[model samples]
Target: MNASRRDLLKLGTLAAAGSFLPAAALANAGSGVIEKAAKPLRILILGGTGFTGPFQVNYALARGHKVTLFNRGKRPSPEWPGEVEQLHGDRNTGDLKSLEGREWDVCIDNPTSLPFWVRDAGKVLAGKVGHYLFISTISVYADGSKPGMTEDAKLAEYKGKDAMAETMETLRADIENLYGALKALSEAEAHKQFGDQVTIVRPGYIVGPRDETDRFTYWPKRIAQGGEVLVPGDGLDPVQIIDGRDLGEWMIRLAEKGTRGTFNAVGPDYELTMDSMLHGCHAVTGGKVTFTHFPVADIPEDVGLPIWVPREGTPFSGYGAVSNAKAIAEGLTFRPLATTVTELLTWYRALPAERQAEVRAGIPLDKEAELLKAFHAKQGA
Candidate 1:
């Protein structure tokens, strides 16, 4: 099963209403660190109201870069720190009339899942922008069972009849089979249009504030509740993730330096295991949380546990171990694990009470309890 299949189910769900991080936390998010460019660059972001785009906008403004956002004007946008030009267009229907004759120093394609989105934008953006940056996923790898895979790893191929003709409706009809392959094709299409000026960033499990998916947020919130925690696997499975803020900020820096190449935008600059991740998040909470280990087999096939994948007999077993050495060598950095956990919980706590009651990802408490009981009984027998 695809690791991100669960997340796609929550697609089109807008950011939770009343989602706001504490002002102090926002101030501290990128404190003591600044990557200002030598000269201001005109930066254009395709989709700037989503999880990571706001971070990019804020950081770019702080670094004295002029920023512009192009997206369907359906969602609410945050208050930008500096002036930002907003243009509206629908890429799904191939309506990119708004971008004609516009030029920018760099273009960041944040939400291109369909190859046609790239094809349509390329018609308007080719040679208009100095650089093209496409945000792709780590799922593009054809064989994810191998540990330490790099950007050169074989990518999944589009098995569809016509990749350029595939639409959002068609993609949703078979997202599990097409999402990765389509993204891989989109990367190729971007290269075909922009050549050496294209930058492909492949990231896994982007978790932090303003993320409504709650894939990684489930852990911090569950641990904060102060009770028995049912942990899948022996807690030895390697895990890789990048805070969205780190990713967004780094992309701006990449645009500033004109860094061009494919890089795995994963985190920590070191090896991180599920054991370390859980305990690291737990450290930020004052609640008493005791964890009980359970076999990966105990997890029901229908149940999707966020961010924990067993190494034995599992597809994408090496998903958590993909190499980020190339990205690190190019100035990729990570915030403290505690910071990610704290800010996520802080942002989550600010959500409406009704929204707080909804757990977007991870096992339900009752189901988790039942599984834990079953695991204990088998051990006793």
Candidate 2:
């Protein structure tokens, strides 16, 4: 089936499962809150066609908020229900001329990778927009720490060049490490431009349907094969992730509520360990699985290791445990972890066989089992 038909079929299937929401239900829960205002809030999202962007767009549209997207017009979205105003421009060239004189209630910055880009965008929208929401990463926290870390923790300081060439070189070398520092610097720039109006949402690994990146996709595919699972650590290492839909909802809620400050937008603080996370996936997929843990040192030098290994001496240090109390207190609640896993599995199964196989490559069940066994054995020895 073609992409369009496939999307329709997926939507139909999800709708039957009660996972999909009608546009009306997506509207504000009640008029007493931010929704009660006479005028529908206008929102501008930079990079609304990418993986996480579409979810935000769908959410805002469902809530009856008017949305305008600013992008280079290179990556067009498939058909969407509501009419979204598109502003064509490239952040690289700093050409946001199309957005001049247009003010919005909120602006979600999704595409900026560099501090300069954020700085320029903020300069343009500073006084024009009410709330400037920066979709930041959990990576901004110092490395290796997990659970209980709050948003005010020490941020990674990035002094590297913000231009394309320098940024690309650093990114190509180590994406995970570089991403946090870069994001921290970018957030700092945004704060400098728009202090109280800026809200930073630092989300942990976000996973859901239509995710182009295969980081979270590996687990579901692995479990579907029904075999021993390869676990990075003792399966005790903390893990946290937020569904894209939930993230989108909370972001919109934050805007509507006029919440400020740095919020760690993640899943529940409890039940955030590697074992529980994988077990959740296993239960949803109904796959027979056992975990084999590897010590940090014995991770084989291979092309396709699923786990992230930190450099020696840097072992899980900064922002290890993040606290979401602030967001929770501000009306951020996640669906059960089991629900997220189940939906993720459903989405995975809905993909065409060809696409499924492409992502499933380099993740054979036996190899995973073998690696897990080696790692576990080393730990025992």
* Best-matching candidate per TM-score: 1
**Model 2 — which ten-residue stretch has the worst lDDT?**
8-17
**For residues 86-119, could you state the per-residue lDDT of candidate 1 as single tens digits?**
9999998888898999999999999888888998
Clashing pairs in 1: none
Q: What lDDT is obtained when candidate 1 is compared to the true structure?
A: 0.82
TM per candidate comes to 0.94, 0.80
Where model 2 places Cα greater than 4 Å from the true spot, the runs are 1-39, 161-170, 173-177, 293-297, 303-314, 317-320, 359-363, 372-381
On the 0 to 100 scale, the lDDT of residue 205 in model 1 is 78
The 10-residue segment with the lowest total lDDT in model 1 = 9-18
Q: Which numbered prediction scores highest in lDDT against the true structure? A: 1
Candidate 2 lDDT over 250-323, as tens digits, reads 88778877788888876665756667777777777785766666564555545343323222234342232457
